[model samples]
Target: MGMIKDAQVSVRDLFRWRQRTVTVDEQGNEHVTFETPSTPPNPIRLLRSISMLGWGAYLIGFFCWTADAFDFHALSIQTVKLSQHFGISRTEISTAVTLTLLLRSVGAAIFGIFSDYFGRKYPLTVNMWILGALQVGSIYAPSWNTFLAIRALFGLGMGGVYGAAAGMALENIPVEARGLMSGIFQQGYSFGYVLAACTNLGVGGATSSWPIMFWVGAAMSFAAGFARLIFPESKQFIEARQNSKGSSTAQFAKNFGKMLKLEWKVCVYSIILMSWFNWFSHTSQDSYTTFMLVGKELNNAAASRASILMKTGAVVGGTFVGYFSQWLGRRRAMIIACFMVCCLIPAWILPETESGLEGGGFMLQFFVQGAWGVVPVYLSEISPPAFRAIFVGLTYQLGNAISAPSTQIINALSDSHTIRNHTGRVVAAYGPVMGIATAIIAVGLALTAAVGPEKKGASFESAAAATTAEAVTDISAAAAPSKAHQSSSVGQATSEEDLAGKKGANGDSHAVLTKTEYA
Candidate 1:
C-alpha cells in the first residue's frame, strides 16, 4: 500500500504541468532550466541547430507516417464504393474501420515491445513491408470478409509503424529541433489525407474499381520501406543496444519489470489522457461530413468542397501549431487550440447555409488538428526511454481502441433527434449531437492537459541508462545529504542537456534521463 501511494505521488508530481526556464550564457550558447517559463531560442538559432543527418531521418519518418495516413484515408474516402462492392450497408462497411482501430492495439503491443527490446530499424522495415503486402492483398480480396481480414492485418502493421517512426525521427534529432519537426512530422497525416483525397478525386473518379487506390497505397508503402533501408539504425537505438551488451538476459528482464512496476501509475494516467484526445479527434472528424450532408442539407459538391477545406485547414493548423508548442509549452498550446475549437462550435454547427457551413468546418478542423499537432512530441516527452516506442504506441493505440465505437455512438445518439432543414425536411439532428459531444470533449482535453506533465526537452537516449541512473540516485540519496544533493544536480544537468539541445559527440547527443529524475 505504501508503495502504491509512492507511485501515485510520483506520477502526480511528474505530470503536474510546470513552466521551464530558458537562458543564454555569455558565449551566446543557450541553456534550458526548469525553474520557470521564460524565453525560448530565436527562430534563427533553432533553425541553425537542425542538422542534415537529423533532417534526413525526420524526412524518412515523415513519409512513413504520411503513407500510413494515405492507406487509412483510402478506406475512409471510399466507404461508398466499398459498400457497393460488398453489397452491404454503409454502416456494415464501417465495421471494417472500427475493427482496424480496435486491433491496432495488438500491433502496437507486438511491434512496440520488439522495438524496445531489439531496435527500431528492423521492426519498422518489416512493418512497412507487411503494410505494403496487406494493401496488395486488399486489392485482390474476393469478398467482404476477405477485405476486412486484409484490413485487420493491415491494422497490425499500421499500429506498429507510428511508434517506431516517431522514435526514429524525434529521438535521433537534436532536442531543440523536436518541437518544430514534431509539427511537420505529424502533419504528414494531414498531408497524406490531402494526397489521398486528390488521388480519389482523380483515380477513383476514373476507375470503376476501388482496387486501384489500394494499389497506389501499396506502392507508396514499398517506397517508404526502401527509403528506411537506405538509412542506417538511428543513433539512439544503436547506442542503447551497445550499452546493453554486457547485461545478462535475466538482468534485462528484471530491470524492465522494475521500471514497469514503478511507472505503472504514469502509464495509466497517460492512457486516460490519450483516450480523451482520441475521442476528441475521432468524434469531430469522422462524422462531420455525414452531418454536413444529411443534417445540414448541403449538396454533394458543397459537402465535398467543405471536407477538402477542412483537411486543408488541418494541414496548416497542424504544422503551425506543432512549431508553436516549443515556444508556448505543450500543454498550453494544446489547451489554447482546444479552447478555440470549443468557442467555434456555434459557428461550426449552427450554420444553415452552405457557405457558412463550409467556412465553419474549415475553422473547426484548423483548431481541432492544431491541438493534435503536439501529440507526437508531447507523448514522446513523457514516455520512458527504454520503452519509448512501447509506452507511447501502446497508450495511443489503447486510447484508440477504447474509442473505436465513437462513430456508432454518435450515430445512435443523433438518430432520434430531428431538425428542420432549409427545405423543411426533417432530418436527423447530427449537428447538435456532434456539437455537444465535441464541446464536452474539448473541455476534457483541456483538463487532462492541464493536470498532466510536460518534459518539454526530456532525453531520448535509452531506457537502460535511465534505470541505471535511478538506481544510482536511490543509493546515493540514502547514503548522505551531500551525496543526494550531488545526485540531484546530476539529474538537473541531464535535463539541461536534454532541453538545451547541445550537440552531443555524434552530433546527436540524445540520452535517457530516468523517470525518477522528474519525480
Candidate 2:
C-alpha cells in the first residue's frame, strides 16, 4: 500500500513540474525533497545551466559512444552478408559477436581503471584509435579465422569507451538535467544502429559492399577520436585531482581495495543489473534484421528501412522516458519501461506486413531502450566516489561478458526450430525463439529493477569532495608523530567552524563526508 501510494504520487508529480532540493541535517545527512515549481524551467534555461564547456564534454562523449555503437552494429546488421562472405553458417558469424562481447570485460577493466586514475581523455582517444585500426583490420581479413580474431580484439577497445564516456558526459551536468541528458546520451546506441542501417541501405545488398560499411565505421571511429582530442578533462575530475594531490599510487590502490571491500554488494548488484540490461537490448536487436529477412522473407532494403524506423522509435522513447525518470524516480521508471516491453513482445515479433513490422518494431525498441536510458546516471549515482569510471565501465562490460552469448544462443535456438513464414516457406523459427527469450528477460529485468537500490539525484561533487577530504586527512595522519598527535590533528581538521564553512559552501559535502567515514 505504501508503495502503491508512492507510485500514485510520483505519477501525479510527473504532470506537476516538481523541483528537487537537497538539504543537510545536523548529523550531516542529506535529505532530498521535491516540491512544485511555480514554472518549470524551459529547455533553453536547462541548456544554459550546463554551459558551453559542459556541452562540449557531453557531445564528445556522445559522439564517441555513438561511434562505438556504429562499429558494433555494422557487423550485426550485416551478419547475413558476412556469413555468405565467409561461406559459413549464420550461427558461426554470431560466434564472432559472442567472442567480442566476452572479452569486453578485460578492456573495460584495463581502460576503466586507467581513465579513473590518469584521465578520460587520453585513454578514450587511444581506445578510439584502436577501434579504428581494428575496423580497418576487419575490412581486409583474409579468412574466417582472421575475421573472428580481429573482432575479438575489437571488443577490448569497445569495452573501454562506455565507462569513460558516461563519466565525462554526466558528471558535469546539473542534477536537474541529468535524466533528460541520460536518455539522449544512451540513445547513441540506437542512433548508431540507425546510421548503420542507412549505410547498409545506401551500399545495396551486394555481398562485396559489406566491406564498405566497415570502412565507414573506421572513419567514424577515427573522427570520434579526433573530436575527443579537442576537449579537456572533466572539470569535476580536475578539481578532485587537485584536492587529492598528496595521495600516492600505493594509497590509491589501498583506497580502491577498501572501496571494493565496503561496496562489494553495490558492485555485485550493478553487474547483475547490467547483465540483464545487456541481454535485454542484444536479445531484442542483434538478430532482428536476420529475423526479418529469414522469417518474414523481406528483402534487404525492406529490412533496413524497418530497422531504421525501429531504432528511431528507440531514440524517441529513450529520450522521453529518460526525461520523465527525473520525476518518476529511477527504479520506478525502469520497472515501468520493462513491464511495457514485456507487454510489447508479441507485437514486436509477430507482424507480417512491412508496415506492421515497422510499427511494432519501433514501439518495442522505444520501451526497450527506454529502460536503458536511466543506466548511465543510475550507475554513476551508485558508484563510489573516485571510482566512477572503473565502476561504471567494469560492471557494464562484465555484464556484457556474461551476456556475450545472447546472439549465438538465439541463432542456435532458431536454427533448431522450423516455422512457416508469410509466403508458406519453412525457415528458422527466429520470431518465436526471440519473442520467448525477450519476454523472459523483460520480466526478470523488471523484477530486478524493482528490488534494486536507487540513489537518485546523488551529488557526484559532494562525493568527490568527501573522498578528497578523507585523502587529505589520511595524509595528515600518516605524517603525525603519535596517535595523540594524529587525533589532535584530525580534530583540528574537522573543527566545528571548518565543518560549518564546508556545509555552507557546498551544502552536501559534509553529509557525504559523514557517510564516507562510516562507510
Candidate 3:
C-alpha cells in the first residue's frame, strides 16, 4: 500500500478518508507523503489547453447526445396529440413513456458491453442509424400497438447512444479539459429541449401535423450519427484495444465478468446515486407545468412560456455549474446546487400568478440541471477504465428505469389532496405537495453526491504500467525539471529514463499520483 489513496474506495468508506498533508522543503518544493489525486488545469484555461482534435471529438458527441434528447422529447411533447389520434386516454399514452424509460436499461446493457468490447465508433453509428429509422417508423404506425412496438425498439437504440458518445468524446480528450467539457457535453439534453421547442414553435404547436416533428427528429439523428463517422476512433479505446489480451466473444465475456467481480461495489453505488439523480430531475420537472396550469391557474400561453424559460435556464445553468465544478470540486458544486434549489422552493411554489412562477421555475431548473451536468464525467472518472462506457451508461439508464414512476407518484400525491382555487372549485393540490417532494429529493441528491467518491483528474488510459508512468511524467512536467531538481532532495526524474524504469516495475499498478510543484 505504497499509495493507498490511489486505490478505489467504497462510497461508504469515503467519509472515513482523511486529507493528505502537504509539506514544503526549505527550497520551497512541495511533497505529499500521503496519496492525493491530480488536479486539472484551471477552469478558465481548460478549454484553451485542449487541441482542435479534442474539440471536434467533443462537438460530435455533444450533438449526438443532443439528438438523442431531441428524439425522446419529440414523443413526450406530442403525448396529448398522440393520445387523441389513437382515441386513447392521456394516461394510456403514458405507457409508451414508461416503456421507453424501463427498456432503456436493456439498451444500455447491450450497447454498453458491445461498445466496451468492440470499438466505440461502429456500434454508436449503428445505434444512431437505428434510432433514426425508428423515429421514421413511428410516424407511419398504423395503430397504437405498432407505435408502442416501434418505441420499444427506439428505447433500446436510444439507450446505447449516451455511453458510446460519452466514451468517444471523453476518452479521447486530454484529462485536464474533461471537467469543463463535461458541462458542455451534458447540456446536449437541454439544448435538445430547446431545439425541439423551436421545432414545435416553427411547426405551430399541436395543430401542426405531429408527423412533421418526427421527421425533423429522424433527420437530426441521422445527421448526428453520420457526423460521428467523420471523427477517428478515441485514442483511449485504441490503446485499450491494443492492450486487450483477447478479442473473441468468449474473451470479452470473461473480461466483463472480471470487471464485475472487481467493481461490484462501485456498480451498486452508481445505480443508487443515479436513481436519486433521475428522481430529482423527473419529479421536479414533469409536474411543474401541471402545478402552473392547475394550482396557479395559468393560461396555456403562460405555462408554455414558463416551461421554455425553465429549459433555457437549464441549458445555461448546466453548462456554467459544470464548468465551475472543475474549480469547486464535483461534490461541493453539486451540494451547493442542491441547496440553491431548496432556497428557490418558495418562489417556485408559492407564486399565485404565472408572472411570479415563471422566473422562479426557470431559475430552479438552472441549478438542478447544473448539478446534473457533472454526472457523465464524474461517473466516467470513478469507473474502471476497462468498463467506463458500460458502467456509466448502464447505471444511468437503470436509475432512469427505477425512477420511471416519479411523475405518476407526483400525480398520485396531487390527486390525493384537494384545495379550493380562487374560483372556489376543488382541484388537486399540486403546488404545496410538489414543493415538499422536490425539497426532499433535493436533500437526497445532495447527501448522495456528498458521500460519493470523486476521481478528479484521473487518467483515462487503461494500460497499467504505461498509465502509471504517464501520471508521474505529467506531474514532473507540471513541476518543471530545473525547478524540481533544485527543490527536491531526491534527484530530478526524466521521462525517458526514470519514468520508463518505474513503468516496468509497476506494470500492473494503476494509481493517479499526487502533484508536486516547485515554487
Which candidate model has the greater lDDT, 1 or 2? 2
Candidate 2 CA-lDDT value: 0.80
Summed backbone clashes in each candidate are 5, 0, 0
- TM-score of each model, paired residue for residue: 0.83, 0.86, 0.80
For lDDT, the strongest prediction is 2
lDDT of 1 at 4: 42
Q: Which 10 residues in a row give candidate 1 its minimum summed lDDT?
A: 21-30
Instruction: Report model 2's TM-score to 2 decimal places.
Output: 0.86
Give the candidates in order of lDDT, highest first. Answer: 2, 1, 3
Q: Tens digit of lDDT per residue, candidate 2, span 1-519? A: 433433343334334333333432333233444433333346566777997888899999999999999999989999999999999999999999999999999999999888877888999999999999999999989999999999999999999999999988888899889888999999998999999999999999999999999999999999999998878877877776775554466666766776776567568878889999999999999999999999999999999999999999999999888888777777678888988998888888888989999999999999999999999988887677568889999999999999999999999999999999878899999999999999999988876676555456766774342234454343233223354333332211222222333343434323222232110
When sorted by TM-score, best at the front, the candidate numbers are 2, 1, 3
Better of 1 and 2 by TM-score: 2
After superposing candidate 2 on the true structure, give the runs of residues whose Cα lies further than 4 Å from its correct spot. 1-41, 464-519
**Worst-scoring 10-residue span by lDDT in model 2:** 510-519
Candidate 2 at residue 385, lDDT? Answer: 56
